[model samples]
Target chain A: MMETIGIWVAAFLTLSMFSFLYKDNPFYKFAEHLFVGASMGYFIPYTFFNVFIPYAYNPLFLRHNYWLIIPFVIGLGYWFRFSNNLGWLSRYPIAFSMGIVGMGVPMSIHAQILVQMRTMMLPLTNINLILIFIGTVSILLYFFFSKAHEGLYGKFTSVGIWFMMVGFGASFGYTVMARLSLLIGRLQFLLGDWLGLIK
Target chain B: MNFSDYIQKIDRRYIFIILAIAVILPLLFPLGLPTFTTPPVLSLYKHIDEAAGTDDRAVFMDFAQSPSTLPELYPMDLAILRHCFLRDIKVLTISYYPQGAAIMQMAISEVKEDFPDVKQDVDYCNFGFRNFALRVPITLGMGDNIAEAVETNAAGRRLENLPIMEKLKNYDNIQVCMEISGAAPGIIYINYARARYGVDVAIGVTAVSAADNYPYLQTGQLVGLLGGLKGAAEYEELVETFANNDIPYSEKKAQNLSWRNQQYELSKVPYKFKQARIGMDAQAVAHVLIIIFIIIGNIGYFIEKRQDKNKYVK
Candidate 1:
């Protein structure tokens, strides 16, 4: 059946990708390159259907609205890469998008990031929290002064380094967890969905 | 650097082999470990409840993610869509990513297994994928010529003729626009649709992008958010709880009047999410593996450093 063939193809593609984990072989390379090509080719029309024709051309040409052309013109500036004289025009939209995105960052920081970090930085009320606070503050101060960190100060800074190392260790652990989750997901598809071996 | 020094370096192949086993073993035989849903996930579920309400809430889901991220991303879309349909809310899906539309269609269809009577383009509509970015969303949400973008359903029938959208006044008919993406366009929706048009937005994004959305969620800009697989799992749990609580009866005489009877009168909800539950277990084990790797890598570094010191002292 067509469904069975689809499952097999999916399994093959997934295994082909995981094979890269063992060693950089031609199979991995072929699959990787194929994926890149397929994805890119897909994105063009995908963007065209989901973004352009609906948002731009529909409003501009179909509705005969003129102002909507602002983004349209800005988007067209990307083509300036081909024109030597007009290469500078590309920077206009780039600068505009930068300005807009830049404006968003400050708003986002005030609303989201700073508050979250502050929330994390709050004083721990428990004994464990107190030790963590003391260690974090002393280490942070040690770095702020930027001294060689010898004597009591050095000892204090060393505690900060230890806290930092632990935090970094947790982050690295989470990153691995995230990547491995994806790998497991692929394997699941190959075994359960594609091959029907585990289902 | 002697030839033996090169040999002393374990081949990357060894690392690959270990990673392969780490992934495969869990799938073949799961540990059934529990994953705790974090605060952000809880917040996201609450927001979805508030925005979608008890009425006919609509979601414009963008299921656009690479296979690399499908395991983490798809579950969130599935959970959210199932929650909406179970609550009898309408869902409208359009994909900005090409592969995304097909995937979204498939996810929606699976949800349909529960709601057999729900007709496509009546109770739901697949506008397919569009490419115009901000321009398209602004136009569509503004209630302009949306038909021009996806003129017809995926089957090539015109949308104007479709019963659901025929009377759709504007994007106001939509209660939420949820974008599950791995890239910039989802954020673009946040800025253009939610900010500009006051659309309630929820984003289900990867962990890396999830942090970035904190600002949006904090700003009250994004109504709800599901981050990676953990968030998806949490959402699924919330729906399961909602479904259980809504069930009509525990008493024998009342059993006939149970919510299950009403549910049977309406849609057929699948028992539960099979894939996401399994993924959560794999994730917990994978977290342990990563922690172990980090420790080993650090030990290797320290060992090499001590050897270098010995050489210098000699």
Candidate 2:
């Protein structure tokens, strides 16, 4: 009986979301608000139990790691943003996080940029490698704002544009597939799981 | 409006209705469209098959997607989990997003239900969500000692005591750290875990992010990738084929092997395991619809342009 009720609730929400395809309606709004409220409700306790208690409270109190209190205090400073008089205090947490991120940027550049460039610099012996190398160089040239694109440079940038268009087209096609997959999921739920219309 | 204009400006509701019918009909009656396994997906399967066998080497599965992407990502998650379980590969599952904990639980339960004797905390364990901010530290810490890095499993039980943790102590035991996410954590895993500890990494990302992963794959940073629903379907096909042809399940207990043996006999793939494959039927039809609409719209546009040119000539 509970399973049946759950199915009905899910089916209702699924149809409510689908109703937006026609136009804006109260059903869609209700479902949207419900989703947000439910997500927040789920997120709060999950964070407290899973993250805060395990990483923060347990370390500070149970383990007696007093140094952990420094970051905890900085975390608490974020609450001060709600107060006009104490709003400046929030900058401590912001600055602390920004500093940590600043430290991480160099490492990230090494991994994402330098490593990627090293990979691209490999011997372009194959057609696939040659195309990849050419595409990367031409695309970089296309975005070269300092120099005006003309003659040979213009032709190179034009090739860059073609490569970019092909990339964009592939990405767009994948996006459509992703969206349709989501729809198929909901429909499968409504039909097979809920209505028993499909096997 | 002219005929060309009318054709170009067809009501979106009509298209929606047609698409709904197109998708729904396929679900009701599956077309059984053939799925071709791509090289990236095949590479992932081959790596897992070869690498993760002994207790010393295991698979670290990062379930980083939420409920919103369940349709696209869940099937791939299930396929990978099923593959691991069938091959007797020890798995340590973790969730990066809060909602991922529930998703991980669901996938495990579904797969575990098939193999009743597959013990939890031994065959598999789930160390639930951690703060994304501490991803670097947590990842690095795992290289030193997993039990110390993640103190507890999802159930709040100590990880040190778990039998699975004995062999799964560090990155050396991790054969492949596969991140099954809509937003792939490839860079983080590559930067910290792979670069620091020499761990092999793979990703099962949503199609939207699939194209972006090609560069990483090209650079040999990622072992393999499963992109979107198509990727999921391909992985599922691989699993089904592997189970049927490979793997000596006959030596094992007959009862433990019954579920898999029954599920993959001849050409009768079970619907539960074929979620992504069945969804592909809808995908194929929808792609056709989109292509037809694009062609008609383009033709209508050209016709309208020619008519306007004729008007100017007049």
Candidate 3:
């Protein structure tokens, strides 16, 4: 019975959202605002219970990890951003986060950059490899503003344009599929789960 | 007005209504346009299948998807978990999105219904929602030591005590890390898990961001990729059509369970479980409708251009 009620609520929201296809009206606006407000209302308490109590309060009080107070105070400092006079205090936590990310950047670069470069530096013996090599070079060259597009360079640029167009076309096709899937999902819920039309 | 003029002047609301009808008809009467699995999706399926052979191994999955990308990501998420449970492989799911962990619980319960003998603590576990702030530390630390990184499951239970965590201590025990998201968090797994720990990484992303990740597939940084609803449909096809359910499970007493011997059938899979393929049917019909509209618009443009030229000549 609870599941049935949940389905009805979801079906109502789905229809309310679809009401915009004809014209933007009160139903769409109500659904949109309710979703935003409800999510915020849900997360505030969830974070306090999940993060604050478990990670912070328990460790400091029960486990006696007093060292946590330093970071705890630093985290609290972020609230000072709302204060008119002491707003400068938030910079400590912000800088600490920035510095940590700065240190971690180079460590991740080897994986994102070096490994990919190694793999792309292939032998080019196979047709697939050759196409990949050409495609990579031509695409990069197309973006190279130093050289004007003429003669040999122009031909490569043209090939790059074709490759980009194909990529864009594929991306567009996938977007279409993704959008249609959302519609199908709602329809499935309404037809099968709500009304029992499709089994 | 001429047909060309009518075609050119048709209101966009009409197109929207047409698309709605086209997408809806397929759900009412599904035309099962044959689904095909790409190499990337197949490779991920094979990885899950191979993980099943080694009873001690587990697959790490991050459910980082949100409500907006729900339709595309949720079906694939269900399919992968179904694959894992069907083959008797252990799975550990964590989420950074506030609501993503709830989706994780929903999916686990749904799939568990399909396989009753699949126990909770021994066969699978959920780390639940870690603070998104801890994503980096968890990603890197799990590579070194999963138990140490995640000391407790979502319920505040000790992770080391879970029967499933016995041999699964680190990335070495993990067969692969599958990041099902909007392509944002998959990069973290690729850079940290696969790159740092030498674990294979696969991603399931929405179709729009799918192209951005193809270069990773080319470079082999990503072991496999599932792009949007079609990708999920292909995965459902592979599992429903090709997964050999005849497994020789003998590592523990759980393997002796009766449901482990039950053969999987396409007919038995619930409609919710096969939502991806059903979505694909709608996708096919909608695509055909859009293609027809594109041709009509082009034809109208050409006729309008020729008529303008004739007017100039006169």
Candidate 4:
């Protein structure tokens, strides 16, 4: 009985969301706003109970890792952004996070940068690997303003543009598939679960 | 006005209605069109199979997507979980998104219902919903020691005590970490876990975001990928074709690594597992509608340009 009720509620919301295609209306607005509002409601308490209490409160109070109090206080300083006078206090947390992020730069350089470059230096006998090598170089060359794209360089730059178009085409195709899948999912709920139209 | 002008001026709402019918019809009557398995999907399936006999070897699945991305990513998770469970491979799951833990529970319970004898805490373990804030540390930490990294399961049970974690000292024991997400959260595993410890990483992402991981797969950073609904459908087919859900635990150890692919019977698959393929049928019809529109629109556009050029010449 509860499952049936749940399906009806979901079906109503799905129809409400689809109403936007007709034009701007109250149903669409209600569905859109409810989605955003519910997300916030779910996130706030979830963060507190799962993240704050476990990673923060428990570590300082229960585990007695007193040093955590320093970062904890800095984290609280973020709430000061709400107050005009004490807004400057928010900089502490921002600065602390910035410092931590800065420390991660070296890590990113090694993994994302250096390692990726190593993979490119391959025996490009295969068509796939050969295209990857050429594609990377040509795309980089297209961005080089030092040499005018007027001769052989122009041909290569044009090839780069072709490569980019193919990449963009693939991305756009995938986007369409993703959107359709989301629609199919909702339709399945309505038709299969609610109306008994499909199994 | 000419045909070109009429074509150009057609209302978009008509197109929407046509698309609606095209997609809706497929749902009402499934075409059961075959889902072709790609290499990336095959690679991940084979990687999971590598851990078939071993109790120590495991696969870490990070549910890094929200309910918003559920349609595409959820089926992949279910198919993957089913694969692992069928092959007698140990499973480890963690959720980095807010809704992830709940999603993980839902998928597990649904899949678990089919395999009642597959015990938890032994065959599988889930250390649920650590917020994205802890993502970096938790990912890197798990490389050295998993129990130390996660600390506890969703049930507040220690990972150290779980039978599943016995031989799992680090990433070495794990086959690959599959980040099932809408976005590229798999990059985290690649950068931190794989880059640092040489762990293999696989990604299952929403179709739109699948393009982002292509470069990684080409460069060998990502071991394999499952892209959107098509990906999920392919995985379900692979599981149906290869995993052979009825194969006993005793027989799984003797299974060959070079298991040949068989024709995936769409009708033979359960309805709960048929969601992705049914969705794919809708996708196929929808694509046909779009393609026809694209071709007509292009012809109209070029003809209009040609007519304008002739007028200017005159």
Candidate 5:
């Protein structure tokens, strides 16, 4: 009985959201505002209690560890938003985060980005690999600047563009598939799990 | 008004309405379609299996998805949690989004029914959400006391008093850290946790972010990758293959109870990833529809371009 009630509430909220499709009406507005208020109300406290206090403070004072306060102060610097004179205090933490993240960006790029590019460039030694290699080189040459449209380079480059277009088209197709899958998941819940219309 | 101008000015509501029907109709009547698993997702499952075989292994689940992408992430999260719990692996879930915490709690409870004997703090814990994604790990890693950061587990208990992790020093004891996350927190895990610590990382991310993680996978940094529901469904299939063949408890327990006994019994629960499989089917139909739309759009473009060319030629 409780599960049924909860399901109905979820279904109603979902419908309220969908009401925006017809027009930007009151129902959609109300739902959107309610969601915003509720989310912010929940998030601020959650972050403080779960992550801030125990992970930050407990080890610092309880364990007699002064070093822990470094992050604590860095985190507290974010509250400088409330201060006019000391508002610049927040930048220190932001700068620290950026610096650390900056360092990581190159590492990740080297390991993840460069390696992936190399893999796509090389390809496995197979029939598909041979085809991909030929296509890639031709595509590269298509942009070659020494001749006019009366030559093979111009035509080959056009072919390369077509290949790139098809690849991009496939990627877009996959994205559509993923989004559709999500929509199906929610609808399935409404019907199969909630309404028991479909087993 | 001109015909071309009128067609171009079709109401925006019409697009939304079409999208609604397109989404709704598929749900009411599913078209079962085949799905093929990619190599990265397969590797992820194998890595998870290998990790679980080790001692006191823990997987940190970050549930940070929102309503817009709910359909995709929920199924995948449930599958990974169930797989971890069934093996008596320590599972710790932290939510970066407030609403996501509730969702994670609800999913964990539902999945826990399959493993009745699993304790709250001992085998599983919910650290809930704390602000500042970078701060949580930085503080925890610094102090060697993560429980001190959060006041209570998801069930609302004093973290210091929790029976679980009373013996552990820090996250060093954890063998793996798997994140079923959305965009922002996924980057957090990669940047802070994976880079700083030597923790084996696996990611179950939304489909949009899947390609982004491919670079990480190619580098052999991420052991496993679950991209949206399809990846979840694949993992389910892989786990289920082994879940069923485990030794039965009744006849075997009469002889002696071993460490594997707890896990064998947990595996008795059904191993179907119903949601992800269903979502995959819907996805197949949606892709076909979108492809049709794209072709139509291109045809319209070509027709306009050709007409312009003819006018100039004359």
Candidate 6:
């Protein structure tokens, strides 16, 4: 009986969301607010119990990890943003985070940039490899703002534009598929899971 | 306005209705449109098939997907879990997002319903959700001691007490770490886990982020990828095929059949399990509708242009 009631509530919300296709209405707004409120309601407790208690409280108190106290103090600095007198103190935590991220940037570059460049440097023995090399070079050339895109360079940049367009088109097509999949999920829930209209 | 203008300026509500019909009709009566596996997905399947069961090598699943992405990502999660259970592959599951813990739990429960004899904490364990800020340290720590890195399961039970962690100590026992997320954590895993510990990484990402991971796949950072609903559908096909060949229908598939497909033949998969494929049907129909509309709109546009040109000439 609880499951049935849950299904009805879900079906109502699903239709409420779908109602936007006609025009904006109170149902859609209610569903939107409910979703946000429900998410927050779920998030706060889960974070407190699962994240804060385990990662913070357990380590500081149970483990007697005195070193953690430093980071704990730094984390507390974030709360200072609420104090008009000490609002500037929040920058310490922000700066600390930025510094840590700065140290991590090189690692990201190593994986995302350096490694990618190395892969692109492979011997172009095959036609597919040759095309890839060409596409890569031309696309890079297209973004070289200092150089004038004219004559032969212009043709290369134009080819790069085509490559970009093709990439965008593929991405767009997949985006459509993704959106439709979400709709299909909702429809399945309403029709099959809720109404038993589908086998 | 002429027919062309009318077609050009057709009410969007009409299109919405058509799309609704396209989606609904397929659900009611599945067309069973065929799905093909891509190279990235096949690469992932092949890696798991070859490396999973040997030397205590387990698959570490990072459940980073949010609820909004469940429709697209959940099927892939379910399919992977089903595959792991069927192959007797030791699995360790974790979630980064808070909501992901619930989704992972649901997937585990649904998949567990099939393998009754399979023991939890021994065969599979869920590490649950962690703070995003701790992602790097936790991943790096897993390189040394998984039990130490992840102290407890989602339920606050000690990880060392879990039977699966007895043999599985760290990255050495982990064959491939599959990170499924709407927002791809491929880079994070690649930078920390793979670069630091040599752990093989795979990604199951939403289609929007799928293209971004291609460079990683090409560079050998990611072993395999399942992108979006299509990827999920493809993976499902792989699982179904693998099950049909290896496990007899009566022994494995029959018992695990979803409630919706109880009346169907042993060969026929349940609708609940076949979500990705069923979704693909709606996808195909919707694509066709979009294409038809695009053509009609373009035709109207060209006609309008030609008529305007004639008026200027006159």
> Chain A TM-score per candidate?
0.80, 0.92, 0.91, 0.90, 0.78, 0.91
Q: Could you give the DockQ of candidate 5? A: 0.37
Q: Model 1: residues >4 Å from true position, as ranges? A: A44-173, B1-8, B50-56, B135-174, B184-186, B189-199, B215-219, B244-272, B304-314
TM per candidate: 0.70, 0.93, 0.92, 0.92, 0.75, 0.93
Label model 6 with its docking quality class: medium
Q: After superposing candidate 5 on the true structure, give the runs of residues whose Cα lies further than 4 Å from its correct spot.
A: A1-3, A55-80, A83-86, A89-170, B1-22, B51-54, B135-175, B184-198, B244-273
Over B73-146, each residue of candidate 2 has an lDDT whose tens digit, in order, gives: 99999998888888888889988777787799889999999888778999899888776766777787999999
**Candidate 1 per-residue lDDT over residues B1-314, each given as its tens digit:** 63334435778677667766776777778785644455566555555555343333466676666666777787887788777666556667766567777678778887788778777777778877654333343343444445544565565556778777655545566676777886752555565555446677778876545655544664566777776677777667556555324432122322233443444335433424646767777677666766686677777777777878999999
Question: Ten residues in a row with the worst lDDT in model 6 chain B?
Answer: B248-257
Poorly placed runs, candidate 2 (over 4 Å): B244-267
Model 3 Cα displacement at A91 (Å)? 2.6
lDDT of candidate 5 vs native?
0.65
C-alpha lDDT of all candidate models, in order: 0.65, 0.85, 0.80, 0.83, 0.65, 0.83
What DockQ, between 0 and 1, does each candidate earn? Answer: 0.29, 0.71, 0.65, 0.66, 0.37, 0.70
A48-154, model 4: which lDDT tens digit per residue? Answer: 76667767887799889999989898889989998989999999977765555663687788777787778887778799888888887898899999989998989
lDDT tens per residue, model 3, A1-199: 9988998899999899989988999999999999999776756665675567767887899899999999999988889998999998998887876665753576568777777667778686799878877777798899999999999889988898888888899888878777877877787778888888886
Candidate 2 lDDT tens digits, A144-172: 99999999989998999999999999999
lDDT preference between candidates 2 and 4, better one: 2
- TM-score on 0 to 1 scale for chain A of candidate 3: 0.91
Descending-DockQ candidate ranking? 2, 6, 4, 3, 5, 1
Whose lDDT is greatest here?
2
Give the alpha carbon lDDT tens digit for every residue of A20-59 in model 6. 8889999999999999988777677777877877878888
